[model samples]
Target chain A: MSKGNATKLLGAATLGLMVAALFMVFVYAPAEATQGDVQRIFYFHVPLAWVAFAAFAITAVAGLFYLWLGYPVFDQLAYAAAEAGVVFCTLVLVTGSLWARPIWGTWWTWDSRLTSTFILWLLYVGYLALRAALADGEQGARMGAVFGLVAAADVPVVVVSVRLWRTIHPAVLVTREGSHGLADARMVATLLVSMVAVTAVFGWLLALRVATLRAEARLRGLAAELLALERASEEN
Target chain B: MRAMAAVLLKDVVVELRGPMTTTALATVSLLVLVVLVFAFGPVWGQSEPTAAAGALWVALVVSGTLGGGRVVAVERERRCIDALVLSPLDRGGLFVAKSAAAFVFILVAEGFSLIVALLFFNLAADAALARTAAVLALGAVGFAGLVTLVGAVGGRAKGRDFLVPLLAVPLYVPALIAGVKASADALGGARLGEIALWLKVLLSCDAIFVAAGLLLFEQVVAGSE
Candidate 1:
């Protein structure tokens, strides 16, 4: 199948699953007696967090590939993944904060998870800023790739922050006992569906971003070639 | 290794002869004390001894971060970092040397800051307080190492002054929390074993950041250049 067709399929699947998940969340899934409607936010919030983590992980792996292989494509892929990860991570923070407001009685807390997420946001923002600051393309990509890998090393720090420090926020999804412990069968089914849907959306978004980057690169290369030819003609 | 030590010794001698960096660090420490005094005036007056320990530790961390954060920018602006990189010395060695220099600079600054805090806040002289200073030293070394590495990376970026703190502070949180808790316990006359967990956490963080900085220094320095 063509790239465009694959993107369309992914996009459709994402939309379909999103609709199904929403219906299941509101209608089929029972609302928590404790959190009530706010509990529903978990369906989207948790999946977005998962997608964000997956995106950063992919970016880091791609960065390692770029450094090892010296392939511009891998660098491009890493850049695209980092951008998507930042976006999703930002969404997770905003939605999580909003969800916390009524339940936790505050919009923000110094809980380990919240603090780690905030740090991750800063790391990626700095990553993008570093790229923007560089005048040389190769230099920018190499610098960003290095930073991407280094920043990815901090992921474990973020993951363990909750366990190491005292936090008011309970581990909702991925507990020490695993997801199987906290979530019942029906909740698990809904969560799994949501995760699949979110993953599809993430894939579609990354493909589009990668395609755009590739197109931009091609245009730049063509322009450089054209300039070289013009200079040769003038010399003749 | 000798070349790296030579560079480290050069930085130390420069700091000693001119003492500008050390003086600046001392000044920042004084400024931190003033801020803490003002912010926690009532608490400062009521619990001067206890507050002094906490304030001193904080001053040390902040001053150290600022000093270390400028290490690369100063070298780069002088075009010395390029020369250093071009030399036969290993990049990891350069990182170690810089971090060591930073650690010592911060220790001196913290020493001066502690004196200032004691003078002004009238903190009691106690064995526990002495041990707390030692713990602060360990914490400073770790903090300086991490910040120096980050500073080297951020120095080449735009808004580096802004970026360095943004990137460094979050990473330093765990260390800061652990260090502060350990120091607090020690200052309160608690046994070292009482704060053993926090001490272990600080040591682990120090090891991790040092290893990471050493391993990644070449890439960051070369790429930035």
Candidate 2:
């Protein structure tokens, strides 16, 4: 299938899954006794966090490929993924904060999880800002790729920070005790479904964004070629 | 190696002769002091000597970031970066020399700031002061090296003034955490071994950044050209 066809299929699948997941969240999944309806936001919030991290990881890998192979396609893909990652990361922060306000009684806290997410958000925002501000295309990609790879070192650091700092936020998925909290079959199944659904959505968004960036690059290249031709003709 | 030495010496000589950069460094140090006073004043009163020691290191890192950014951004602005790239010296060696120059400059600034902090805050000399100074040196070296590479990359960017910090600060976190822990231990008069964990973290980060910078420097410079 063509890229467009694949994208369309993926988009359709994403919308379908998202609707199904939302229904499951509100109507099917049982509410926690400790937290009420607000807890349902976790279905979307956690998925957003997962997809954001996945997008950044992809950006880093693409950056490495661009540096190694000097491929413009890889650079463009990395840029697109970083942009998408920032959007998802912002969603995670906002939704997480919203959930926290009702449950934790505070909109913001410097708990390790939230702090690391905030830092991650800032890193990508800076990444996008750097890309937007740079004028030279090739040069910008080179710089951006380097920054992407370097900045990615934070992912693992962020993952390990809570362990290092002994902070309040629980490591919901990583730690053994936290895993026990989700031992319920229904909860685990629902979370897994949500993860898959969000991953599919991220893949779909990335495909569309990459296609758009490639089209823009091609237009710019053609414009540069035309400008060169005009200059040559005038010289003649 | 001698070529690298020459590059390093040239930067040091230029800096020594003009001293504008040093004065700027001092000014940044003062600004850090003011900022720290504001940040920590509520918790530990501005008159507390120990707080000043901790705050001094924070100031050093901030000033180091600004100074490191200027080192390469200045070269790019003057159209001299291309000349540097075209020179026969090894690209990795160039990275090392520039990073060394930045490291030394920051160390000097940190030393001056420490003295200022001691005087302003009435800190008494203790074993902790020595240990804290050593940790600051290690952290400063690593921080300067990383920021130098970041600044070089940012120099080729369109909004370098904005890009350098965005690229550098997040990377500075591990170092900042380690530096603060080490400083706190020292200020509390702990043994060198007491802060060994933080020291190891700083050392590992330093080694990683230096290696990455060396490996990536040529690609970054070539891409800039």
Candidate that would win on DockQ? 2
Per-residue alpha-carbon lDDT of candidate 1 for residues B78-121, written as tens digits (9 for 90 to 100): 88998889878898999998888888888888888877876777
Q: State residue B69's C-alpha deviation in candidate 2, in Å.
A: 1.4
TM-score of 1: 0.88
How many residue pairs clash in each candidate at the backbone level?
A: 0, 0
Q: What would the per-residue lDDT of candidate 2 be over residues A6-69, giving only the tens digit for each residue?
A: 8999999999988878777777777765666677788888889999988898889999999999
Clashing pairs in 2: none
lDDT score for candidate 2 against the true structure? 0.79
Segments of candidate 2 deviating more than 4 angstroms: A158-162, A167-180, B45-50
Q: Tell me the TM-score for chain B of model 1.
A: 0.94
lDDT string for model 1 (A99-125, tens) is 878876678776667777877877888
TM-score of each: 0.88, 0.93
DockQ for each numbered candidate = 0.40, 0.59
Error of 2 at A155 (Å): 3.4
